[model samples]
Target: MKILYINAMGPYEAWPQAGVFVSERVAALRKNGVDVTACSYYQINSPAVQRVVTRNGGPDLGTPIAQQAGVTYGIRKIPNGFFSAAMQRFRPNFWEKRIARQVRRDMEESKADLIHLHWIWPMGLGVMRYCRETGVPYVLTCHGGDIYSDMKDMRKRPYILKMLEGAAAVEFVSKALLESAKELGYSGKNAAVVYNGIRTSVFYPARQEHPGKTVVGFAGVMILRKGIDYLPEIFRRIQELIPGEIHFYMIGSGVLREEIEKKMAGLPVDFLGTIPSEKLAERFNEMDILLLPSRQEGYGCVIKEAQACGAVPIGRDVDGIREAVDGFGSLIAYTGDDDAFISAFAEETAAYVSGEKPIDRAAMEAQAARCSWEERQKDSIAIYQRILGKAD
Candidate 1:
């Protein structure tokens, strides 16, 4: 079956680690002999648009049909905000009508068996409208922000609700998010919880190279929400308490990088900036433990990826991480509880180093296996086939 995975976001080269997971999952599906196409609205204006694409790695729209794992992708040169922009200037009636007509044309040419949408908002809703017009089956996977943040946006909600109403199935990464969706008027029958999966083969546990200095690693967007700002103090307290060498390895960069650098000024922390996701396991092999004190998370892929590589993760107990970790490594206080986090950081790192409780490679591989792209793609393919075979 031909499937079109629709999203609006980024220059695939700069995609976040999670984007790598999604891309690999789609690649896995294609390897299983499924026809998959992607429509990424990459390089769009607006912070919301960027967040979606950045989170999902706008697929390689420039990929040739063969290079794209039997998938073709395109970037819409026309941004989706002309109507809202024109609304401020003059009557938006003509522009609004034109958008509907153009959306219909795009859908017909694509001719997808199923439209699997990620991040249902203004752009996603357009896909929903086309599905409704053509009586095509569509599914939406909510990855936060779109539903939780923009649900109240006037133009956004109507489309979100329409998408919800028309979707053959709806998926959220977390139970909290699923609950949020139910509360937000999504009463679809096939509403289900599907956790994001990872590539365990590429991200399996590795042998530790450093046994002398206790290394605490972190990877993800270096934004305030990730609790990167508190790393300086956390490391300082760790150094003082342990009185041993405590090295910090931070990966990824964002708006908070400059400010975080200012805060950590002369500290012993090693900021590697952003490295490709494929290289993370190598760093994981070097590190003693992974730290992700994020204020929020959606399946904490880094936590899983690190754990898969035998780097025990110390994360803030919230949403996806709480569910993903499931008593694996250390669970600290929510991002606000700095004191508790510092205390836990030292204790956990010590335990990890002294072999009090080493990361269980067998258990981690087992857990990681449950969330693999191969497994997820199987379920996804089933979801598509079921949707297609359903009575219209």
Candidate 2:
């Protein structure tokens, strides 16, 4: 079957680490003999677009790139600020017709059996409109921000609900997110919880010998949603409780990097900007624990990545983190309780230092193994086959 995977974020060469799961999924589907292709809207600040903007000294709509994987069409980006938000709120369908026009053209050209839309914000709405007009079936995957953040604005709820209702199937990365969709009045048919998967060959555990101190790590975009502001306080408390030299490796970069670095000064933290996937796996192996205190997460992919590398995951008990750490690691603190979080961190670190809470490396690997890309591919293909009423 021919399947078209539509993503707002393009999985391109410029951003090596971006859309990793999407790339892996497309590759897996192709390997399984499914004719799968990807299409994305040109991200405004993407490396390619930024290069053009830098050369021209202004934003310009450029030609989209066509590759064996799929095509990426350029689209106007809403400017960042209050004005943009207000415009989006007031004129929700401002870009809908344009995006849908492009998507409809692409769909007709590809002659796809089904379309799989990644996020349900602007893209899903447009694609849903196109699909409805042409009587083509499509599945929608609500990846957190679109549902939890975007849909929070009642203005966008009707469109989101309509897209969900019109989908051939709706998939979420976590059960928590699925429930959240239901709570937001998504009474859709063929709803399923399909956890995101990791490429195990690249993320598997590597044995490492620690000479003295245990290292705790955090990997992902260092943003507000990640609860990075709380890291310094938690680390400070953990240090006071544990006598050993504990070090923190912050593995990713974002808008709050400088501020977070300033706040973490005088602490044993190393801001390792951004490491490649292979090196990231090695870094994960070096860590005794991985901290992901996200205030909100669609699914904590880092939790699984760290776990796959045999690092024990310690995260806030919220949304996807709660589910990811269910059988593999420890979940600490009620969400938003700083004091409780500090206490939990202190306890976990103290136990680790004392060798009382040793991580079960084998079990961690096993749990992570269950989340392999091959398995996810099989599950996804099964969903597609079911949607199309065909047998494998």
Best by lDDT: 2
TM-score of candidate 1 against the unseen true structure? 0.83
Q: Residue 354 of model 2: what lDDT?
A: 74
What Cα-based lDDT does every candidate model obtain?
0.67, 0.76
List ranges where model 2 is wrong by over 4 Å: 10-16, 43-87, 390-392
Put down candidate 1 lDDT per residue, 1-392, tens digits, no spaces.
88776654333444333245446656787878887666654323345544554577432233212112233456554443544554624431223344345556656776767777777655554666666777777788877667667775554565567667778888777776777767777675677777777777777766666646777778987766687876877777666755466688888877677778788877788888777656777888777778787776767877777777777788887777788787788787754566876777767667767777666667865686567777777777777778888744
lDDT for model 1: 0.67
Off by over 4 Å in 1: 12-18, 46-72, 80-106, 152-155, 335-337, 355-359
Q: After superposition, how far is residue 322 of candidate 2 from its true place, in Å?
A: 1.8
Residues 1-392, candidate 2: write the lDDT tens digits. Answer: 89878766444443335555666677777777889767766434455545655586443333333342232333324332444334666888655776788787777777888999887777776788788888788988777888788888788888888888888888888988988888889884579888888778888878686867778888887778888887888788878877757788998866678888898899888898767778888888888888887888889988888888888888888879988886777877675667877778768867866789877789878888778767787878988999888423
